[model samples]
Target chain A: MIVAAMLTLAVGTYLIRLAGPLLRTRITFPPGAERLLDVSAVVLLTALVAVTALTEGGGPADAARPAGVLVAGVLAWRKAPFMAIVLAAAATTALLRLL
Target chain B: MLVCLAVGATAVSYGAISVASGLPFWFPVVMGTLVLAGSSEFLFVGIVGAGGSPVAAVLAGLLVNSRHLPYGLALPDVLGGGWRRWLGVHIMNDESVVFALTRKDPARSYWECGIGVLLCWPLGALLGAALGSAVSDPNDFGLDAMFPAVILALILPQLRDAKARRPALLGAVIALVCVPLLPVGLPLLASLGALAVVPFLDRTTVEQGQA
Candidate 1:
């Protein structure tokens, strides 16, 4: 089951990735659609962050996780190195969980 | 490079956690190469680990990856056509796209970043698989927090642009609100509804420009 699912997902995702370049010449997105595409990365990414940080098993995660993500956010906002941001978040969460 | 290190760190966690969840170590190592996209792979492992149906996991993972459609659109030039384009698209992920767009030579940067991540992600997974047994609980070390933290860091710079900020904020709100109500991947898909505000935001920008 795992292997089959992974294979299907890999193929499906590959097609989605290819759809843009393949269709780029044949079709043109309207300006609004293009604008939506432009912002989609940030929008989707923000949503991913929110969902991953706040939810677990279709519900709210513990306070420690969100608090840790908040720390990472502040560090990221300050342009800290990627490793530092990750480490800080992990450390903060682990410490909070320990308490 | 720094990008490779960041991806490797997260991939390590992914590998370890997937193994700890009862997936065979080789499974994540292989998936890391085949899927290549971190977020969706994580979602897939999380669902299947929790005993969700494989069909459901695949569907949810595909939904999580729908963002790649726009990512591919944004980088048509970087991924020039021909047989090479196949590899190009296969390696397209959040890290590659983000890094490629920021460089002066996007085509070269894209390939270099993409290939680097491709190498490190799977290798990191392999290494973490080896270490998975040492750490019985990824959450105890707060490894679970790393995925979202890294992703948040990636998008933070993009959010600095006022044009992008509004939609991101709205999308986040949409996802957060739907978290409890929706299935694992559906909330993220529903967040796409935030794009509805883009037209209105564009009009305001245009009007302000003329003023």
Candidate 2:
């Protein structure tokens, strides 16, 4: 059942994804809407990150996770390599876990 | 080539995170293969693991994925016409669309875009699953700490201009406040709530840009 669910979900997602190219010709956003759509990615992604970084254990973490996220934010602002931001945060978490 | 690299990199990263977090190897593999959207899949797994209902998981996944609807509406012209063109557009995601739209070569084809996304989807899932199975201690490499940060890093480059930036900041603030107040699935709802405000708050900006 799990496998079936997974497969169904996968196909549905693929279909959803495919909708863009398939309908590319049949539909069009107005010029103004197109501009708004362009920024949608940023809004969507930021909300995602915020939810992940801030919330934990069914509620917001008091400090440690946010601290880790802040470190990551700084690395991100510095435009450090992707690996570095990840490493810095993970290392901080592991260290905090130990202490 | 860059598209291929991005897909490949994402697959590897996901694989590492899943394995480190002790997720079933098959889960992330299936997620990558089926969901195709990275953030949504991650949210689904995290929610399910945290004991959220499957229905909630599905709704959250769909909400995060709602952005694709507009992308669908916008892409038809670029893909041209026909059944094949339709199939191509249906599979288009952020990476493929950006690649297709920005290709300097006028001759660049939607076929290439379709093929790239389709091919990468499974390969990434398989790779992540395989790697997850192989790594006994995924945390030794510090992947758990790195994964969300890496995901966030990938997300940042998309915030291009002031109009987008304002809503993004608003959404982030809402998410932060909601984090303390909501359950697993409700935060996603709150995020959507944040997004719902984008049109209302930025009507002037949207109007100005559209004009």
Candidate 3:
């Protein structure tokens, strides 16, 4: 049953990933469509990040991770190196966990 | 090619991790092989681990994976041509798609991107799944968190305009508010609702510019 479920999910997911390009020849997005597509990435990514950063211990964390995320965000805004921001956030989280 | 090697490494790593973690072994292996999208796969594991229903997991995974649609649509224009075109479209996952699109001249045939994704995605997943089963404490080493960080890394670099920035802020606010209000899956839905404003905003911008 588990294998079956895995296979079913795998096939279904693959089909969706393939669906866009499969129809690309048959479909052309209208003008400004590309711009909308571009914007969607930002929105989707922000949503993902916020969800990950804010939630902890089965709910929103009281503090720490959110603070770490904010610190990372500030570094990101300042155009810091990607590794630096991530390391800083992780280090901060580890420190907070220690306290 | 370098891209192909990267894709292979990614798949192998993914497979190893999944296997080491003692998940339904085939789940991550197949998901890494076929689903080939890391964010959705992470969501899949997360939902399952949280004891959510399969329906909820599937829905959440699909919602996250929907971004690939735009990627597919945008690719042919960049790749251009016959057989290579179809292959290019097939391989349009996060990394390859972005790399192909962002290149000044890209100059890669569709087959190159297709081959790269085909190689990297499955191999990475396989590696991770295989390794996952062997490792007792995956989280202790921070491997689980690496996926999200990778995703965020890919995403943050692309918010280069006001149009992009505004919707990101809106989506973050919506997600933050919804986090307390909705169940796990529903927050994602709410975020999508927030994203609906993006198209309207873009249209209004174009009209104002013309006026």
- The per-model DockQ list reads 0.71, 0.40, 0.38
- Cα lDDT of model 2 by residue, B88-197, tens digit: 54556655544444345412544675577567755775686677657554444434444456546655555545655677788677767776676443454455344565
Per-residue lDDT of candidate 3, residues B103-196 (tens digit): 4555464446566667667666766665664644433333333333433544566666666667777877787787777655455446655557
C-alpha lDDT of residue B94 in model 3: 59
Candidate 2 Cα lDDT to native: 0.60
Q: Rank the candidates by TM-score, best first.
A: 1, 3, 2
lDDT of the structure predicted as candidate 3 = 0.60
lDDT of 1 at B82: 84
Candidate 3 residues lying further than 4 Å off, grouped into runs, are A22-24, A56-58, A61-64, B1-27, B43-60, B70-90, B94-137, B141-148, B179-211
lDDT value, residue B176 of candidate 3: 75
* Deviation from truth (RMSD, Å), model 1: 2.4
How far in Å is the alpha carbon of B130 misplaced in model 3?
A: 5.5
Across B122-149, the per-residue lDDT of candidate 1 in tens digits comes to 9999988889977566688787788788
lDDT, residue A71, model 3: 65
Binned by DockQ into CAPRI classes (incorrect, acceptable, medium, high), candidate 3 is acceptable
